[model samples]
Target: MKELHIVCKVRKKRYRYISQISNKITPNLLKRDFKKDDPNIAWVTDVSEFRFNRKRLYLSVIQDLYNG
Candidate 1:
């Protein structure tokens, strides 16, 4: 192996400024209303996972709020 000489350069420090705004509150539209009057109006979907024999299984379901 042969010896080598290396040169290093220094960089100036940089700073960043961030501005923040106040948060506003929003109202809820559903308000725990799960019932629907007409069909195909509203539908809810959920995903569930289970473990079986060292393997993972996922089940996805979508039900109509009016009928179900």
Candidate 2:
């Protein structure tokens, strides 16, 4: 669905925008670099789907770079 694509882009781009400007939003914003040395600095994760018993199972993660 279109909404799914829009949301997926939003989720991925949220971290990108936040990394550059702290508590600020801009129309012409540049993408943020994914390089940090803090535990919560790099919170990267992914999601996937698998069929189980004819039903869909989704998986997601919110990882910490320090612990991982």
Each model's total of backbone clashes = 0, 0
TM-score of 1: 0.52
The most accurate candidate by lDDT is 1
Q: Which residue pairs show backbone clashes in model 1? A: none
**Candidate 2 lDDT (Cα, whole model)?**
0.66
For residues 1-68, could you state the per-residue lDDT of candidate 2 as single tens digits?
Answer: 78676544443433344566577656632145555566665677899988899999999977765666
Q: Cα lDDT of model 1 overall?
A: 0.82
Instruction: After superposing candidate 2 on the true structure, give the runs of residues whose Cα lies further than 4 Å from its correct spot.
Output: 1-35
Once fitted onto the true fold, the runs of candidate 1 whose alpha carbons sit more than 4 angstroms away are: 1-29
TM-score of 2: 0.43
Q: Write the per-residue lDDT of candidate 1 for residues 6-60, one digit (tens) a residue.
A: 5566978676654664476777765788998998887888999898998999999
* Cα displacement (Å) at residue 59, model 2: 0.9
Each model's lDDT comes to: 0.82, 0.66
